[model samples]
Target chain A: MKKLILATALVAISFGATAQRYFSKTAHIKFFSHTSAEDIKADNYKSTIIIDQATGAVQVETLIKSFEFEKALMQEHFNENYLESDKYPKANFKGKGDFSKVNFAADGTYSVNVAGQMTMHGATKDVSAIATIKIAGGKIDGSTKFYVNPRDYNVQIPDVVKGQISEKIEVTVKATLQPLK
Target chain B: MNKKVIIIVLLSIIAIGGGVAYYMWNKPKTNAADVKPNYILPADSLGAAFAKNEDSANAKFVKDFVALEIQGVVDNVFVNEGNESVIQLMTNTPDYAVKCYFLAGESVSANKGEKVVIKGFCTGYLMMDGVQMSKCALIK
Candidate 1:
């Protein structure tokens, strides 16, 4: 009888480890560009992200053509000329971090150091950022802000229109995670 | 020379004016739709049942109904349900749905395991065949 009880406890703990994985997505993604004439900014708050609590494993993806612009014509150019969304329809990220030892017991803010490979326009790069993580009421929230250069992902800016667009753009990401099981 | 130039300019104006009037009178009419401000994803819905297929052709991409194949459930939306009982779908997605009115004696819906592609403007009401407006239906 004691052996049966012990075995059940072991299974429960192991199951808990995997069951803690959570993810929430709203397709919320934003992009910004700067130019001498005006700043171009667009965002869609519907990006998707998933995280494994025990392993700190993170996977993120956003629709490339989902970026919204204020001007209809500008949006058309972005998809056809700049982002080339048809060829590369998604920007993806897959990375792992250490969350087991982190302080998640309280309802406060934590600045987490992250290192991962972000794939945009079919190219992957190492990325590191300080993401703010919040835990409350059995829910976990994460957000981060960063910048991307067009050249980093081979995004082309024609010289004739170079003055109309910015060289570097800011990107911000936010996600909420819910228990999967 | 000055008189000739002025005559040319006046004639040009007359021709252009006539052309403008003809174009305006013969141009195809566009159905202007109202902006629909509300679209909410259903709670805990997943893709399961298939949208009923009817033998329909000439189905306005999203005329009879508005639906989003979100997660799994067909979140069929109608700004205001009135006379249109069924809609033929041209596209469906997790985020949005586009459809049109069907007049052909045939029906079309997404096939099994097929996903919706494309996104478009959403409206608050449905407009019918340039004659009158129904409550509200999804349009392509």
Candidate 2:
């Protein structure tokens, strides 16, 4: 009986370690803007995420000023005036979801929603994001997209130059989530 | 010699005055039509719809444009502010000048005696000097 108990404890510890192992740093983030006059796009969001399997939790963060625009001045104004990257430099999304329910015997599709606080421009809002995970060849792929507005975070503009900026800004995310080996 | 000096002075004065007049005549001027019509988010207004209090009644009520007849200062221009509003755009282009993109809202003036229609989004604003604006635009 003691031998069996020791074996069960060892298995539990091993499972804990396997569930929360560190992952390789390889993920991508992008954003796009559309307007009547022009459809401008910037894809330079550097992102990082830390997942804790034991606690069923995850944390994701990316810089706003990293977005590259066609014009340097607009980029400057974007960080300084619009998004205020100086005041609110980073945009973060951290939430919890379950990963243990996978029916590993047969590979298939699963949908999950991560509900947490998305902090941007110094404002923390409760955001529920959906993730579509596709499993194949012992690897997992994930993707998500959402929208944001400048005014929500207190980024303000004056009246004189108001015509140059759009009302709503679109933010999108795509990443290849891989488990720790 | 005195008479010649006086005559030269008079000619020089005439030449300087003529040049000044010509320069003034050729400088770029803006008429009411030259002042373009566009959207501008007001400095004092409501915030965006996607805001955290996104469901708040105030956010939905803040209109994008305010129509009226008055003079206001927009980029140092003094024209009859039209019924259409003004809004600002976010850009890095070299003063694509008036090619500014705007939000839909209204605003107070930087100065007086200027006419305009300000269009912009409402946003919460707080400054180090205790200045606050409920709605502000990202005017280019």
Candidate 3:
């Protein structure tokens, strides 16, 4: 009986160590397009992200309709003609990296490679980028900037306004996550 | 036809085309306060609708560009990193709440535990963030 009790306690300890997760609901995700004719930008501040400290796993999800553009006409065209947000309202990213070298107890910024599957506009593609993880005051701040071609994700750009939009769109993700209690 | 008549017709076409192009370029964003809500109910019902079937809920409230007026007790209120006010309303699901993202520079007067009505457009629901509403306005 004594041995069995010790084994159960040890299992509980191991489970607790592997279940460390940090979450944030209001991550900021912004995308910009620049061209000779025009520069357009949109911001989405309601993205949800979860990071597992034990396994270095990260997941992010944001609604396509949540993105707000400066011009209503451009936003309408983006939804109706380009993205078709009514059909695919969510964009998701799931990736993992090596977090073994970093010590979460201390404050520092570490650069890591993140490889993931990005799903948007009903298309999924593999993506890899260098992401920065900043630890301060026991909080995790993760940020990454990357570029993606809209056509790769099946985003059709009409030829009439091709000059007004960039072929490659710049995407930035930033979030400050707190330990999940 | 006379050359003079043809010249006048061509000029008129160019003028009308310019006007239409300008209107499309200068269209305004949607303001929740200025538009009538397509659905009016408690926040809990909205949350439950999404919880039950996300696709149908999105098709009905989000894809159709439906505005909603939700009444519920305030779960919390805070300003996001973008300097926009965000209000969370209590729902039947303990793990989820209705998040309303108010327009920039909009003042939110409701306090925690207060029952209030909020008007906004349903952007859709994230599994982790529940139902999200943008361009929010305080109705009461």
| TM-score of the A-chain for all models | 0.86, 0.80, 0.89
- Output the better candidate (2/3) by DockQ: 3
> lDDT by residue for model 1 over B46-105, one digit each (tens)?
110112321121122223223322122223322211122223232332222323222122
Docking class of 2: incorrect
Q: How well is each residue in A22-86 modelled by candidate 2, as lDDT tens digits?
A: 23222456666676666667654235565555666767766564455655455556767777654
CA deviation > 4 Å runs, candidate 3: A1-19, B1-13
TM-score, every prediction: 0.59, 0.50, 0.90
- Candidate 3: clashing residue pairs, number: 0
Count of residue pairs whose backbone atoms collide, per candidate: 29, 58, 0
Query: Could you tell me which 10 consecutive residues in candidate 1 chain A have the lowest summed lDDT?
Result: A19-28
What is the per-residue lDDT of model 2 for residues B1-140, given as tens digits with 9 covering 90 to 100? 69999999999999999998776545432112222223333322222222224224223322223211112224432111121123222122221111111212233244333334432222221111111111222222
**lDDT score of residue A66 within candidate 1:** 48
Query: After superposing candidate 1, which stretches have Cα over 4 Å from the reference?
Result: A1-19, A103-105, B1-73, B76-137
Ranking by DockQ: 3, 1, 2
- In candidate 3, chain A reaches a TM of 0.89
The residue-level lDDT of candidate 1 at A97 comes to 64
Cα lDDT, model 3, residue B65: 60
